[model samples]
Target chain A: MNTINQYYAGLDMGSVSIKAVIISNQKITGWALIPSGGNYKTAATTVMTQALAAAKIRREDLCGIGVTGLGAQSTPFDARPMSDISCQARGCHVFFPSARTLIDIGGQFTKTAKITDKGKIADFLMSEKCATGSGRFLQVISRILQVPIEEIGELSLTSQHPIKFSTNCAVFAESETISRIAEGAKPADILAGVHKAMASKVNMLLKRIKLAPDVVLTGGGGEDAGLAKAIGQIIGHPILVPPNPRLTAAFGAACLTMETTSG
Target chain B: MDTQSQVKTTAVKGTDTAREVRPMVKDIYKAAHEARENGKKVAYMMVASHYDEILRAMDIVPLPTENYAGLCAAKRDMDRFLLRAEADGYSQVLCSYARIGLGFDSLRKELGHIPEGSPDGGMPLPDMMIGSSAICDPRFKWYQATSRYLEAPTFSIDVVAPPPQADLNRVRDYYINYQKEQFQGLIEFCEKQTHTKMDKEKLWEAIRLGDKAWQLWYDIDRLRVAIPSPMPSQDHFSIMVAGHYYTGTQKAVDFYQKLYDEVKYKADNHIGVIKDEKYRILYGGGLPPWHTLWIFNYFESFGAVFAIENVYRGFDPVQVPSHVTDPVDFLAWRTWLRATAYHEKARQNSGNPTVEKLLGIIKDYAIDGVMFHACRSCRATTVGQTHIKTELGKYCDLPMMQLVSDMVDLRDYSEAQWKAQIGAFIDALEARTDQE
Candidate 1:
């Protein structure tokens, strides 16, 4: 059996960014997140190297590696590829043991996963055929509003009277948002409207699975206070947000590596 | 033609039923072509009605409309036909199989001949159409559309849903009698259309053969209860083609018997379709995305095998009794049974019938998980699927995933999304197994 000093790595090659996490003795030692920029392989390698350097661990010392997310299968790594659902469940369970549901809003997809008490996935629903309810929708809104994607979430929270967006489609919503801007709508209100549209889509997915508490939000959009507020408002309950939401799937992947290798 | 050479096998080897039945499907298509060239009367029918025997009894070549749609989808050539249908004012929201069928028929009618890219030179134009009101309303409407286009006579069997809190014993006689009348009407129509008399003895023999084949199929399904599941779910696609298209023939019995022997042999030898099978899944709800059956091969690569599909179990002996002595009564009873099986099973389980049926199969097959295909074009199958999934959670805590795709429309399918969802499901199942 491997000793406690043994290190493991997990890579999450998401549509928007690549994240890596290094763990030793079941604790996260280092983590890194970088823009995927349509080059997942390079981003994966760069993040892994940075994460390993942060953890002060040698590559050979790693016992196993786990990969998850969009580019997981194609990433240049000799690692076990796992589903983001399992990784997210495991990763969130480590921080929020009471979490029964995990909502992950990535750049190109949104997933609502029901987690068992043992941190395994019981069921999950992923966005289908379109990117309207995902982080990509927020990116489109940000590009139209000329606001930084990261800052839009905080700006949305300041909206007092958010205008309603008629369409849930990203392309149509973009045109609607522009029309709203031309009509002198506040940027915060437009961002808030986008959050509301995203929340409605997420709520529809969550209803399908019948959300169980405590609901924990993770992924790129999980860290957005505005989106979470919108979801919380719609669901009629506050949600738990883990620290470094983008790294949770990677962390879970690393933890899985240890469990699989040790067994 | 070398029949063996014509049968295409996947990289992931399928059960004997799949291997033999695939060749039979090719022959069926070839026979249909020959029948058309010889000016034999051909009848287009929906799969749910169990009218193949009736057609065969009248010496009419039976062409299953949905099966042909599946062929077009599998060949990845459904888009042109679908677009043609859409251009002709058929809603994209209509059942994809209907769209493909309607589109193919319309395109052929316009060209005044089978177009070059038509799948299997397109299905032979129908002299008549037999439709049922059982499974989907669209099926009967689709048949009606085709009948009008072909200027052919159409016979529809009215399969009424059982009343709420209905006892099958009390309602069985009423339905059987009504169905018997319908069967007589169909026979009369066929006799007049084909200029031939109804041969009762030939019909009885065909029904007997069909029952025997269904019995063998039931046995084949039972064999999947074995650990490692000797039968692969994808193989069912080919096997069921025979079931749907050739139910009342000696060929059906022969195909099932050979398939039964092969699956039984594998079970006895402890040989699984997938090596090191770790997870067994039951696929329920909606038709499989015919274009991407390789998804089964992908799952098998992860040591996951789909043990059963609900649609494959549609004609199981348990659902329809196999020991009937009267051919007319047998056909009537079979139709009534098939129509009510879903509702009755659901009533018994106190859940959605589709889900309840899936749960029963899961227990019988020792399935590790459940996957529901939420086909965009198949509202009848997909409606209340979420309710079924939730209710299933009450009976057992098995992990479940719903994949969204259309049965024939490849445009609605997102391969990346499917992979991610299914990959996660397999991972969860593996984790549960490890925990145990």
Candidate 2:
């Protein structure tokens, strides 16, 4: 039997968020999510320590470290830095072997990965250059309404008559949103419309990767019911969203740690 | 006009020297006279000076492609040629220029395309071609694919950027020499096609004139980005179209000199939006879509003036050698190097893996935030955006926004969601400024 004594760490350094997960001897240990806040280095260090604390493990105990995501190669930890696509695909595949597609929509970037049964990326797509249709985009609209980020999904689900906003430039879209408000467009409808736009963006991304079935929605924005429904409507198929979508990456990272340590 | 009256409508618009179709009354008469005398068909396409070397070498008269009715008229053709443009990641998330190029490509094909060429007229497409992929990779693939159909010979000049760690100017100088060789090779190709030896003296003379024209614009460009923004986008856009053809001719000198005169006049008289411009964002590479003026308006709302773009600016930066000096050789020399110099510099910079210089750029430009676009397949620009972002974080407290979209293909953008991201980015900028 494996001793389960060895420890491993996985760090995902992103534009707006930092996530870390720790595993001790092939069992899911614990995870941490913190604001990257434009400081990838600091965010990395902080998240590592936080994960250690959550798992009740010592940093010295970590035997191997694996980092992934946008800032993966830039983290302070000495480990093999993999592309975000590989990490997400590998992380997601462990829980569900049948899952062929993984959609990771973070606060800043959205990545859609096509995973094989062997946990290798056959192909992938990402929305890293532009932040439109991303989670932070909704943060902006929600802030204007002075609502909490957590509440947007529920509110969007309740909206009637989806309000359509013209333009793809975020700067202009915000201004257009003001037009929607001026036109007495319900916030729910406007949110639904925004959700529809996101759906379209994701649909386009999926089409490129051949639109893999058994798609799993992960990341911060994955929890949004409206966005999932919108995406479902566009892809013309039912999609699965992991519970507490925001914690999915960390969970995946935690699982990554377990795989590395046991081996 | 009937709703679909498909009379021969000239699709040429804007100032793209590569695609513009101005019926030169005299040139037409001359080509007609020559063709009539020789019993040959007369046709021609005017090319920008930058690419003039290639088109001329191929014995093709290159004409600048323009965008008049839309911000970018070439979007359709580019889209058609590159069916999976967005999927392939050739465009950055915000590269609307690529999108516009698609339009131009689409509209022009309807009227039997004009190949870039002669000061006289359209290129006599005999059945073979060769060119460079320096500006982009798609054109290389496009030409190659076209050749597959026509059985035309095509050669691509792969661009190599200098190592960022190496001497920047030295790298530029090196590429200049290489460009000249490529240009000469192209010239030889043209000679073979025309069945005539090009007078070295005339070619050199053309080069000398082209060098002057290119230099004038670069010099003018350096001065255009004043603290009080000296130029509007409309003028900038037009100047770029004209500037493309100025690298190797009397045309460069004339157009740039006139541009300088206009800009100097405006700057001296304080004629344009030059005061209290809070932020100056580098428009960066690719096309900015007029269809989405709201994108610019978003920045303008935050008092951010997109001062200058490298793409629209064209290949104008240079030192104009004396007129007495050999000019064509100089242009050919530089053209070879331009393809690879910037990439080499970026590679060199990343070798040591430090963000100090990137940080300095942020400070020098007064850029409170960095927006590193992750273009889908433009390995040249988007290869290491995330890495750059990490390095950038080391240097300053600026918020970095990475937006996603296909720069060239229009069918790829998610209209509403893209707007959402930009809106958030502006709000972040505004919030940052307010805090400051």
Candidate 3:
């Protein structure tokens, strides 16, 4: 049960996945990610159980829990729900204390938050009425190209000549990709094109909030090396990615849980 | 069923002003239908202009395009009409209100009758259309396009923006003269179309009635500054439709008077719009999504009430001096003032009028947080919103969040996503309050 020290947990029930993190003595002890699927409650329970086992801590030792993301409110947990914007800022601040800008590309939406040196969110911009620069877009293209989502990034990096995608819409882009494939375009080229489009859209959001130096990237889309490189190319600067980029929000939630419990 | 009876039967619990406002809106639609059947002239006016009084004075029925668009959106019936307009080569990027109105207009023209499933048997075709250069460019094009299709005479009032440093009083005469000449020209145009001369006495009466109604509306809104805000902005949204289209008539004056009485009653009894109100919020930008107004209920569940909305705040006409006696001059003053009041007020407060106005509202209403709708179709309102949030951060320490959705299109809205964002915002507000 590891009763020698107190433990705190965070659950981020995002649209595409359920993420959980366990922290002890201000350090991340364990984290887990599982597809959210249709039933978020079940997914959250499963992920939290896996996270606790990985941390080798009993549920009774947890002092508090914090939740975030789209499915945060509905999670069946004794946790305080927090906005992803604030949690993302907190999570990134832990990794890069100088980070003044944070970009989170999740499943259904992409958000850019401007953070203060004190770890507070100064302002934010989010994708609206479209999913052009979100993880869902990348997943859709992966299915069409008959490639695993994780491998699309490595494959894209190998392209010698990338095709240009004219549309930013996910549905329309799928048709465009299919047609390009029919015309004998290489898979690497198509994937690279998708990455470029995603980067351009994300760059627009960043520009709106005026990207500050020491920008941090997180969320599911942050795992894609091709997209990260594309964003860096578009902005002409390096971006910071946390060690556990996809689990940052959950980690932030754990931090919040610890703060509130200690207080 | 008659509107009054329908309102009494279907009104939601605890919203008296909304119940009263619904019947008045229905009556406007009914009048439009009757005017068409009786062969009387009807004119379409954009929401940006303050010309409803002039039309009503000449015995012309005024049909506001935005009001009809709102009705369609509230009923969730905009899909068919919007698709119809898009099919006819109208770009999808055009405002949804314009798309719906143009689609309905085209369908009515083709069918030679009110199309099936039209909202309230469709709006009557206008014999004339009036637009202004005050708000957005698309409005000008919208009126022009519809005027061409209906073969109706269209008159556009050119409203020049006041200079940043210009004294409104010193430059007032120039604008008044220019607007007066245009008003005279419009009267002459209407006289020729209807074969009737404008009666000076009737024009004066309409102006006085409209001015009285507006003053009362302003007073009613002031009551909202009370703790636990007596009414939600949704009620104000419904009532403003009457203020937009029927302010020149006794019906609208009476509506406002009754609304004022009810709101005052709530204030006296300390009856908050949301029971046990925990938080008061200011809706800082973009228009309310008419399709899912139950979004208010979502906030209500958390004991939060939107004390005021930016659109509703801007809807009030600027106060005209009591000394302006000439009806045309008064109308001119109102037209200019209504067009530029929000911006002028912002400038008076120093930097970024929108941001200044919101900060002022937060203090006046004791706002706990701010929420921006970030409507997808409205560029004018949605633009600079993030900047406004940033600017507001410099002035006030309140929590703010932006919810991205379309103004009228249901397809662009995801209830789950909206709920998630709203829930998160509420949590932020609570966390801040606890820290304080």
Highest lDDT, which number? 1
How high is the lDDT of residue A81 in model 1?
Answer: 82
Better of 1 and 3 by lDDT: 1
Candidate 2 per-residue lDDT over residues B174-228, each given as its tens digit? 6666666666665665666556676666665655565566677666666654555
Clashing pairs in 3: B346-B353
B117-220: candidate 3 lDDT, tens digit per residue: 66666787788887766567767778888853578888876655575457777887887788778877778878987899888789989988987888888898
Give residue A243's lDDT in candidate 2 (0 to 100): 51
TM-score head-to-head 1 vs 3, winner: 1
Residue B9 miss distance in model 2 (angstroms):
20
Error of 1 at A205 (Å): 3.0
Interface RMSD of each: 1.6, 13.4, 3.5
> Scored by Cα lDDT, where does model 3 land?
0.81
**Cα deviation of B401 in candidate 1 (Å)?**
1.4
Q: What DockQ do the predictions score, one after another?
A: 0.65, 0.03, 0.31
Candidate 1 lDDT, B54-84, residue by residue in tens: 7888789888788888887777778878999
Off by over 4 Å in 2: A1-263, B1-51, B54-60, B63-128, B148-155, B158-162, B165-181, B232-235, B271-276, B286-294, B312-329, B332-365, B368-379
True contacts kept of 2: 0.03
